[model samples]
Target chain A: MADTTWLTLAPAFLLGLTGLLVLYVDSIGRSTKGPIAVLSLLGSLAVAGVAIALPDALGLGPAGWSFVSFTLLGMFALALFVQPGSQNRRLIAGLSTAGAVGALGVAAAFLFTFDGEPVNPFGDALVVDGMSLLFAVIVASVTAMVTVASYNYIAEHSYQAEYYALVLLAGTGMTLMASANSLVTVFVALELASLPSYALVAFLKENKGSVEAGLKYFLVGALSSAVFAYGVSLVYGATGSLQLTAVQNAITGEFTGMLGMGVVMVVGGIAFKTASVPFHFWAPEAYEGAPAPISAFLSSASKAAGFVIAFRVFTEAFLQVSESAGEFLVLGADWVLVFQILAVVTMTLGNLAAVTQDKVKRMLAYSSVGHAGYVLMSLAALSGGGATATAKIEAGQFVLAGGMMHLFVYGFMNTGAFLFIALAEYWDVGRTFEDFTGLGRQAPVASVAMTVFMFSLAGLPPFGGFLSKYLLFGATVNSGFVWLAAVAIVNSAVSLYYYSKLVKALWFDERPDDKKPLEISSRPVGLYAAVIFAAVVTTAMYGVFGPVSDAAIEAAAALL
Target chain B: MAVDTSYYLILSAAVFCTGLFGILTRRNALLFLMSVELMLNAANINLVAFSQYYGNLTGQVFALFTMALAAAEVAVGIGIILVLYRNFEDVDVAEAATMRW
Candidate 1:
């Protein structure tokens, strides 16, 4: 751990390498589809198999199993999309190769990272630990799914290599964001993640909706990042350092007005990234208009990256300091109350807006915002400082872990829902509740997968979402924020109404009599595989909740 | 004599507000990008001023980084605006709103 171990950097490098290779091969106009497909199949199988078998040999314990699960799931998703005979065979082959390579990166991340032992590869500027790797798993897995699904989603599109390369690049950026421990790294990584995403959102340049969504997304993103940069400068002015630990030590007494402004601006910037209230405007338009897999990627993986930074900065830089002595709660209580209010308003507004939406995509967008509110509970729970940082750590770990676990679970269930949309889009199945009618009879398997996603997203009992939601609220109550927990519970109940609408539309409603659709063409193999893979993870998460929760709690403990 | 840090702070604040005003008032997509650049540069000024004040290179280095990042953002922004104009036949952001905000 002390030596300069470059082992941890391999995963991100591999992803970037694959992305470049795809672009290079495409530029050179090589039709290496047969070999590419063969290599991807063999590579995915080998990585998955090797990771599963080596966990015991290497004594990775529970963490190894976690790594194995990611590898297996990623390979399984890739395995499904390996079929041949598509018009965009080279595109599909190249993308699948990139995805399998991404999975290989996840395996590398797991192999290098051990449980309870955090690795700092580039000093404190970057960390290779439970929190970062957990997020890496989420981002990389979602990227894998998106790459596979986009095989069909953008099948005939001309810029196939660019599409996959941008995705892998963005995935690399999100992974870096999780590990960034300095403001400089954080800012750079944010842009690295976002720039490619703008192009991806507007990938379908011919479509006005896609173009418009990209413009709005770019405008908002540029504005927010400027705000964020100014905020970082303010913090630097107040504290005289960019490092989190230095900033933590610098914030000794009451927050100066400068520091206060810095904190608010910083939070504002992060809010836009997570699609929270007041900054969530682009989410609906972007998600509704862009190809659905990108929507899935941004909502699940990108959002998790934002929260990981929030967790890191607040814990390492802000929350650890301001310890109280005897009389009362101290400097830690200030921004926390602000966070609490934001959480309540964001969750409530997101759900209420979702209820009024007629378009399913827009509704999912708002629900993503609502879920952001739920994850915000982690920050909200660090309400007061203890006598020492250790005391604060103890008080915050359970509640913080709740949000972490929720994000982990949310990554699966939410991505599944959006990928279902991708599947429907692939079929040119119409949008909206009515459009979904009788389609359940058409594609029973994908519909059932969608049902699992909806049920899980609604936090129904016996589903994966329920456990994570329960843990989040339960920890909030334990943190003495019973009111926050109450609001969250009520929101969950209201959310059920909308989530079930999709189910009812799929099953109970009759297909419209007048418009008889033509017979279907060949199946969208990639979309179905990705959707089902997500669905399987959504359900299968239940069996391994114990290890997942432990890992999340362990991860949160390091930051707190 | 070196000017006080507060003077630089005030200058940057004024620049930031002006940029914010342009963003609020302008409809042109290119103008919006220009406004964002002004805002980002306002931060760059703060960073460079703070580095001088703190006697450290971190802020100065980040300022350099900020410059690069701004240029990169502008490049992406221009590409997006070009597409917007191609699709909507206008560079105004208002014209680009096919979906209800």
Candidate 2:
């Protein structure tokens, strides 16, 4: 077999091993999930390292698929953080392994495309390209981190194993979505991610709040999927093709009217995923009701998948509008305006609503939506003056790079915030903003870590969020969306009030007389994983920004 | 003498509109689910109509696949609603507001 073939199979191979181990260990009554988690994490790390080490000498030409499995591979390493304490130990292990395995499977799917013939016109449903690879890594890593965080987070829960498994499956679905090349593939992959999440959201199945959250999520999620599928059918109706490249080729100037409608429908479907304004009704309830670690995964991994798919569709497929003189395919000006409006509304609503929230989890949910708006600025940048001049296109690339880099940064800060909430819950500390009062005095390490996370989220200097915001807004300004950038700046300032409130509650507030140390059965390897992610994200702000920037630039180049 | 594609399109539109209305208005979780199924079937009608008109089997195959998936969805949706009903006596979604904003 070719080296690439093994590379493609690597994810599946690792996942298969983990699944077998999980089953075997469960049968033997050896419920020590730590070893299984360790095994899967190591497998994931090895696969990523091997994929990255594979020489660039073997290039799959333009018609050929690009090979990069590092994203899913890297996710394996990150999932080591979410280990449960002792109760339902078997379940947590299984879930951790599943998350790792899912990452592996996704990597395999991408790798399978590398040497394969171009299935563009013939229903190659997923294109394994640099862009997909980058996104795959980001989502996978986040999945890994969430899983690792969960082990410690869900230590006392009874259904740890099933929870981990669902998380893994969701990761698999997201990976598939990131690489999806056709409309049908996109729908299936998206559902694969979403269905497991429906279960995960209600993991506390006995709790009424959990059940209600799950139902609301299911109803809204189903509606959104229908909307998305309908949009796909419309594109098929107008263009007579489901393959993205073909759709792009078929939607000419005469077809613009129908294509625009189709685009709106498709965007509406995806916006639900990203929790953008108008389609964002489900986010807060779902996030608040879900177990904290799951919330982290949903917010970070799920939202990133939305943006990746949006980038693939809008930049590569829908934006292939006909230029005058019939030479170039420039993005339409209307898309820029649509995206700008979405950014403003999503950000303003997310931040404004968050300001009034008392529950920590719900506030974070709103914050995530606000960040989604910030990410949209890059998409707006991609469409320059309704024209496809080379300069304008290059500027779009820069904006996209900035947007993508921010996603990478935000994942850490966002996940860390949820992890702290989970920890607070574990310690029997309060989960409301008021409950966090004097946390800096009680739990110094957690409080400090949480403060770092808040500052990062608020886009303060010396943190990853700051760099991401600068890059995103700077790119927008450069793309001639100075006013959009200005609005973003204002939104950032508005976001400060809520984030600072959390900070003040944590550090400056007086401690109550009854404050006590959070009790736990045992500390597992999960915190190590979170610390690694937090460290990387924090240091990345001050160090190694260049590599991430270069990677984003390269990925964006693939789009242009 | 041409077969009427527009007539089929109109039927699809009508069915889809009905499903959409049900989804928007129905407070009962079960009814909302059935409405989603109707909308999916309406999509299938459009697909089959187009496949016949274009002389392509792809859309027909897609419709078949979609129908199978719809069956799976129905099974899962019902199972979930059963759980909901068990937990809360009535299946009214409005009353299932323990997790609401």
Candidate 3:
């Protein structure tokens, strides 16, 4: 933890550079996007290198700070933005690079973190721990990839500069949210991430659906924030504490009804952000309405941030209270049952709705919701002995770790799918199922990549998605939640129908009259190659699960 | 003299519920947005009350941040509404179903 200051300075520096990049690009009149992008990407990568070096110098353990992982992921994701292109190329490159670097720095904080242990806080408003660091890495990695993917995706637009800036800002907000130690920090970070997203959702202003989607997202998001703050207030009133860890000491092992209500309201609010069932109403429209790249960011980075924060807040802090402290109390039993029900409904509804969607983005959005349900089921494994039951809660931690892995894998596959859609849509419109017919005949590379993403999402073997899903569901079953795992299995099966339909359309159906050999004219083939590389590595590494699984398990152990 | 905490909570809850009802029942997008603002303000009131009761500066600071965020949200919210209104001539949530159920 000696060099922990670098973790904070790295992101702060990147954020500052972004403003400078914008100013530089503005001064250059209009054509300097390319150089600015390359410079920014290199700068981000350098910061990431600094982060990686920090771990070696300061060592990992508790001192490496989670921000290191975040910074590295940011560096990797920025690789997508620095692609060679003419469509506001410099600005996209610069912002995307800065965003990635920012994410990496944030993740590094956990590796070099010097905070107290789980359920015990040390930071002013941010709690630095393995759970938060794991999430920081997840958010940074996915954000980097999505930002890179978006570079080519939004190349032709005039407002590309603004788009990249907002995306970067959004990413910075998400990282802050992940490391937030207190409810007050959580709210500020949540809004920081969300407000930018509303604008990004409506970035395609000419599209009516985009405008409406943005409005819907904004209103619902504001409402959820309000509801969440209210729940925080009630918890403050009941426990007389705002620090998540402090809630443990304040709850007098009384007021079961009030406790249950507080937990439910808070869960409901976070659920909206994660797009869990019932609150998942806006995901599909927003995805379909927004540009393809933005859709990728939403489903990947944003979703991961939601789950990570939700997991830490619920399982780490509240779970123990519900189980041990609430013994012979109403809150413990009622809240557990409610979470169980939510898991079932969310997964079931998401999969069923996905099966009916014709638009690929919309279908993926629903699938994303289903994924949230699967993640939520991990909460069912919490032991409720508060911090004291750490020994007995290994099963819950395993499930939680598995959920985290799934989020990481899904971020890659989901965003890659959207990238394919964007690449195809840019050349030819209509993202409906019919439009994908004979895609294999036209753009063989994209079609095949799309197939890989689809199969991966369906949880087929030889893919990272399959391994993650197995880990999660297996852990769920191990935690004595076989029924919940069974539901997840069925949901994954239901998901296959829609996902495979895309594959079938790509390979089997007749080529549409408008189907022409699409040109890979935009960012060269190198960018697509990177996307494919990520997909391949994700799939190929599944066979060697010893290290990956170990890493995840070790990460989860830090939380409990 | 200390003010009753429950009274403030109940009032906040009442206003929040009213906003929830408006969002659910009302068709107009403008009214829907107004309802959301009301909900946000309700949360703000709760924060202030808790701040006073607990004597915590953090609550008041957080309330201030929430207000700033709410303003930004409203700005973006209204911008989108204008875009929708220009495109459809009506800002009714029910009418904006080009994407479908």
lDDT of 3 by residue, A71-153 (tens): 54445334434322234465556566656756566655544452435422325567555656666666666666666666666
Please give, for residues A203-315, the per-residue lDDT of candidate 1 as tens digits: 88899988988999999999999999999998888888989878877775544877878888888888888888667788888888888889998999889999888888777
Off by over 4 Å in 2: A1-123, A253-257, A321-333, A385-388, A512-532
Q: Identify the runs in model 1 with alpha carbons over 4 angstroms from their true place.
A: A1-4, A30-88, A91-115, A321-333, A384-392, A513-519
lDDT of each: 0.80, 0.71, 0.71
Using TM-score as the measure, what is the rank order of every candidate, best first? 1, 3, 2
lDDT of 3 at A168: 70
Candidate 2 lDDT over A1-560, as tens digits, reads 22343333334234333433343233233354456556764565565455455534347321122223334433543443434333447464655646474764575355334433222321366666656666676777677777777777776676454466567657767766777878777877788788778878877766677777777888887777776766666666667777777777777566565557667878888898888977898899888888878888889889988898988887777665333433335432366678878988899899999999998888999999999999988886676633456666678789989988888788778988887777776666776777788767766766777888888899998888888898898888888888889989998998888999999988897756676543444444675457456646665666656766776787787776
Please give the lDDT score at residue A67 for candidate 1: 46
Instruction: Assign candidate 1 its CAPRI class.
Output: high
Worst lDDT run of 10 residues, candidate 2 chain A, spans A60-69
TM-score of 3: 0.84
Candidate 3 lDDT over B1-101, as tens digits, reads 47797689889889989999998899898898888888878877877887788777756777787788778778888888888888889988878888774
DockQ each candidate and list the results. Answer: 0.81, 0.51, 0.60
Docking class of 2: medium
**What is the C-alpha local distance difference test score of candidate 2?**
0.71
- Pairs that collide in candidate 1 are none
What lDDT would candidate 3 get against the real structure?
Answer: 0.71
